[model samples]
Target: MNQDFQEAVRDTPGGTAEGQVAVVTGGANGLGEVIVRRLHSGGCRVAVADLDGHAATALAEELDGTRATARGYAADVSIRAALEQLLADVLADFHGVHILVNNAARTQAKPLLEITPDELDAVMAVNFNGMFNACQIFGAYLAEHGYGRIVNMASLAGQNGGTATGGHYASSKGAIISATKVFARELAPRGVTVNAVSPGPQDSPMVRSIVGEENLESYRRTIPVGRLGNPAFIAEMVALLASPDAASVTGACWDANGGLYMR
Candidate 1:
């Protein structure tokens, strides 16, 4: 297996997987990392899957040196074969998987008109295709197992054409929202739930880079809440949706955009 698919091995600060075995895509950095940590703290055995194998392993080791409850697997969500291998590796290491968080994504700051075809394809490959395939592959397995949770990382941009992010990113997320509903309906009867978390301008590196330090305060004022969203809180939303308690909720997009957009 490639290093990307290698299962390396985290400790639960507070959390069972059912035993709660969770595989978090793009779990090596940013919001995805936070979700990984949050789930681990909530007693879930976590598989920190990311493109950066070394970083994933480091985080996994930091969470659990013993590698009993936490581990890292490297994967490129855009590649079907890589994802398939990831599933096999995770199952081999964790025995059973109960949660799947589709957080892997790509974005560019290029303007819509200037956006090259290649750029759009690259973003969609990771943000949409990767997540969709994971749902199909993992959803089937979870349904077969008779229980599972799937929380996808959506964005307010998908609903409102995006702010600072690229056009391709927004389109990918919009597709994600639609697919979340479809998958939820398809898997609901099998004891599996599929949902999405859409966040607005968050206090994350990505947002910071997009908005820039000089314009951040001005941008915050445009938000109804007058502040950027918190990444940790967004992670909490993912955690809540992934919990067994949230079995009743599916095909829903929970928003945390600080009133940036409202239904």
Candidate 2:
């Protein structure tokens, strides 16, 4: 294998994304935050988009102290117009985008039967509609550019029907997994690779909020790794998937579920 491919597999701390431009949704906190940091550290110019503008700006300021490698924007991905504006702003600042990481999502742990229609709709708006908007907008941009990376954030719940999440959340993620393949096939011809990363229950703030400490520990005991996944673990996978070295890796859903949902 080539050294670059090996480096991508190992996810080393280097400029794998050197000079590239990337946009990450829900990048203000949790797994998205870690992904933004990792890509920036890999020498990529990153645009951090989130609903919480202040938090996003704070993170961007913290990471890009020099304000040269990263910028943050407040955006609601559920709104197609907002996403379009975000795309325009990112292009204006970064000139062009080479990577798009769809990491924004909402998680609820209610029982399937108890999940109300409103709850399902709200979750779908963010988890599914938001992702679709980004893919459609950025996916087109990448296709036009003739080369890019698109990493959609999925979950183990989608594949295994939610060990710790609800039906609404799981179903949305399942849709994302399916959409990844469709986009992958279509964009491949344009030199754009689309893929998804399905992480097991991680110790992210979202997961913690959904699954309390007691339940989290209970779930951890069931995993073969015996511990909840860390945000960095998921971030590493996004880093690899966003890197130029990952050009040949696409149209697949990567598993980082600590053996909880082995395929």
Compose the digit string of candidate 2's lDDT tens values, residues 1-263: 33332332344345377777889999998889899998898788889999998898899999887767889899999899999999999988877788899998887778889999999999999999999888899988877767779999998989988735789999999999999999899889887899999988787777777767768778778889898888887888998888777879989999998898876
**How high is the CA lDDT of each candidate model?**
0.88, 0.86
Top candidate by lDDT: 1
Q: What is the lDDT of candidate 2?
A: 0.86
| Worst 10 contiguous positions by lDDT, candidate 1 | 1-10
Question: 212-241 in candidate 1: lDDT tens per residue?
Answer: 899989999999999999999999899888
What RMSD value applies to candidate 2? 4.4
Q: Point out the worst 10-residue segment of candidate 2 by lDDT.
A: 1-10
